[model samples]
Target: MTGNLTRAEQKQQTRNNIMAAALKKMSEDKGFSSLGLREVTKEAGIAPASFYRHFSNMEELGLALVSEAEDALQAILLDAKALEEKGEDIVASSVQVCMQHFRDNGPLFRVLAREATGNSPLIRRRIQRCLMNLNHQLAEIIELEMRRRHRKITNPLYIAEAISTLVFNLGIASADLPYAKQKEAEKRLAHHIRIIYWGAEAMANSQHLSRNIMLS
Candidate 1:
């Protein structure tokens, strides 16, 4: 299997190995900031010098991890959109999907949540940027749904921001909970998401009523 790989493929495989090693080391107990280059290289079965061949420094490697996470989240967003188009209850379905992801990739996301608020300014910014991009993507989805349903909302972006913030905080809170507790947390999340939509619809109705009164 090793000999058949092209040089580029081998190099890419090594890079992936290094990334996997770093991610495996990260957890709620061991954050990205505390990881040592030597340990990661040892786990990857590469010399410490070989680490520099793939990453300029640990910060660059941290950014690579964040990039991979962004790809995963983007995939989730696409799945949510598909569910919406199918007339599924997107809020409940999305919460379940996100919680399942947390269960499967708990350490990876725990690292991201920690590093976003960690002492490293560069890592914080990169993770935040990824989240902001998700926020925008979600806003676009909300706006399109509003248009499809002929509903008037003041700003879908604000709704999206509220949903994103709520989900981020709640998802982190629930990630490590026991199965029953996690289900309760997810129920709360789904309820809050519905409330946000309901509140937006009420606000839109009020604005419409105000306009009618003014025209009269």
Candidate 2:
């Protein structure tokens, strides 16, 4: 006789498959609100009642999809961090990675951004938490770079928040724009990053000059 899997394990596997299928369908349509529970269950090859075993409703499923999108975006950022060791320009590498990620995962990002604005408290909170986590990660990197240059950062948190919001909004906005507008948006994003980097450098230099004068 063949050994059978446990009920919990099978349920989890089914849930995972449902989420995967739902994301695939959302990506194809680029509209989460239009996707119903029956559609997801049908796509997953499951009955309508089985969908409830995995998620309470489509809103809950949408929140889970936002987490998945955040994980995917974080992987790209981690890859950019690795590229920092390869003698590549950090800001340029970062922007390239971000743009590529938006291009690759536009559907997921668009769904999360659009649905989070609707009448779902759970989805809104999940999206906000993911953004906060991302901002913190970016802040850590900015702090590390400042320490590497022996620079004093007077307002690192503010700078990091500004950069994170700017980058995140750029990715969201680009996903909805036309091809020509997308190119212009990317250039504008790059310019914004460059301005932030230069301002940080100038602030560091001014601080150094002030310390030297005080010592003298």
Candidate 3:
């Protein structure tokens, strides 16, 4: 019997526990390549055979961990979207919200970060695909901000890619930092974001101005 859940809920709970165990195991300075199914099942307090009930293999479990990390922080985007609608500095707001999530969900961030740089080639590529999906989602928001402000970006995707690079890279790097350095990293990231914001503006405005100058 698993907790207070019915049979079906217990089954789902077991699956969640397995994933959590994997995350806990991988939380240290390690990656998925070092995780073992037996170790994860033991930590989850389930039979190793039961792991197959939820995941076909270790790679499947690893993929689920990546997806779980994404699901965990979807709220940060919701808050950032709301702030953008309010015409706030979404870049700065998102940095704070994200680092807060990093603090709250350090293990999940560690899972994503280490897996991204893990020794498993397949896992590395899959994680890159996941990050690219997040990049596109961010691009959509950038387009929304542009339209809402009546601003033009000749290539919103380009700007979004740049911002995504900063956020994703700095996120992992910052997470791996000592707590003392996190605040400074946040400030540094904020400066990087402001530069991105201004560069995106210039991408459209300055280019348009140059066009006008050449026309005259």
TM-score of 1: 0.88
TM-score of 2: 0.72
RMSD of each: 2.1, 4.6, 2.6
In candidate 1, stretches whose alpha carbon ends up further than 4 angstroms from where it belongs are: 1-4
Overall lDDT per candidate, in order of appearance:
0.86, 0.77, 0.80
In the range 49-81, model 3's lDDT, one tens digit per residue, is 988999999998888877777775566667777
Q: After superposition, how far is residue 158 of candidate 1 from its true place, in Å?
A: 1.2
Task: Please report the candidate that would top TM-score against the real structure.
Answer: 1
lDDT of 1 at 192: 94
lDDT-best of 1 and 3: 1
In model 2, residue pairs whose N, Cα or C atoms come closer than 3 Å (at least 3 residues apart or on different chains), thus clashing, are none
Query: Per-residue lDDT of 1-216 in model 1, one digit per residue for the tens?
Result: 999999999999999999999988885277788999999999999999999989999999999998888887787789889877876667867889977876766666766778999878999999989898899999998887777777778688899899988877787778889999999999999999989998999999999999999999
**Comparing candidate 1 with candidate 2, which one achieves the higher lDDT?**
1
**For all candidates, what are the clash counts?**
0, 0, 0
Clash pairs of candidate 1? none
Candidate 2 residue-wise lDDT, 1-216, digit = tens? 113868877887888788887877876754677788888889898999988878888878887788878887688668766765564666766776777788778767776667667567777888888877877777777767667656666566677788877876788778767888877887888899878877877887898899999999
Worst 10 residues of 2 by lDDT: 1-10
TM-score of each: 0.88, 0.72, 0.85
Residue 77 lDDT, candidate 2, scale 0-100: 65
